[model samples]
Target: MRPRSRHRVDELLRELATWEPKELRELQAALGGLQTALERESSKTARQPSPGHIEEKYIQRGNKRHGPYLYLRYWEAGKLRSKYLGKKPE
Candidate 1:
């Protein structure tokens, strides 16, 4: 990665490092909720062949007015899907 990109990642890491215990717990709970929702949704639909793999990813959304927020990304049936996680607590 370029220096700028590395620096940006470092900055994000630093920001994450400053999160409070409560905030971390909130994020964890959100993740659990997401997992449950996925499971329920999948169960409601007919089973399909696995797309070889499934991945959970974090994505950053940039908005000039609202700053940035993180989202959860995943794949189902060879298609990409995402859900809004939450904004970093102030």
Candidate 2:
């Protein structure tokens, strides 16, 4: 932590020692609620998608092009793989 933030936290903690048991319990409950909320939010953004490239592909048959589908090109286990997403525009 930065020096200023550390000083503020230390000062706040020192003041906590002077609080009564009832006040401390209330503080603990409030902090517990806040901690739960923060953890829940943290887990949500943590499940990120693997880094990859989105490509548009098509297949030619006779005299026609079949599709312009979306594919995710990602590397795994020392090999490249293409994951089909959908036939959507880029």
Candidate 3:
């Protein structure tokens, strides 16, 4: 087969880039729909009163040489929990 033309390849690349914004909009809409569905499900399955409002406590750690670090502590269960949404501390 003959090689593809450079001009044709550039045109196709430009078209692909131009399609990105529309694709992103579609993705955002789908995500919003999914979020709404999840919230509806959560509301239907409630067994207890919603947890108290989540609070974020930012703290700094580490030394000057190693560089300081920022962390978040959530107040729950009468304690300061260092995890967010069950995710391990980074």
- Find the candidate with the highest TM-score and give its number: 2
* Better candidate number, 2 or 3, judged by lDDT: 2
Q: For model 1, what is the error of residue 60's alpha carbon versus the real structure, in angstroms, after optimal superposition?
A: 30
Q: Give the range where candidate 2 is weakest over 10 consecutive residues by summed lDDT.
A: 45-54
- Tens digits of per-residue lDDT, candidate 2, 20-40, equal 988776566545444444455
Model 3 CA deviation exceeding 4 Å by range: 1-19, 45-90
> Candidates' TM-scores?
0.33, 0.42, 0.29
- lDDT string, candidate 3, 1-90, tens digits: 546697787787777676777665554444444454456546775433332222334444564242133233333435533323332245
- Which should have the higher TM-score, number 2 or number 3? 2
Q: Residue-pair clashes per candidate, as listed?
A: 0, 0, 0
Error of 2 at 39 (Å): 1.5
Clashing residue pairs in candidate 2 are: none
What do the candidate models score in CA lDDT, each in turn?
Answer: 0.56, 0.64, 0.45
Q: Positional deviation of 7 in candidate 2, in angstroms? A: 1.0
In angstroms, the error of model 2 at 38 is: 1.0
Which is the better candidate, 1 or 2, if ranked by lDDT? 2
Model 3: which ten-residue window has the lowest total lDDT? 66-75
Give the alpha carbon lDDT tens digit for every residue of 1-90 in model 1. Answer: 579989997998798799998877555555554675567556775654332222334454574255245555544434545556567456
Badly placed stretches (over 4 Å) of model 1 are 1-15, 45-90
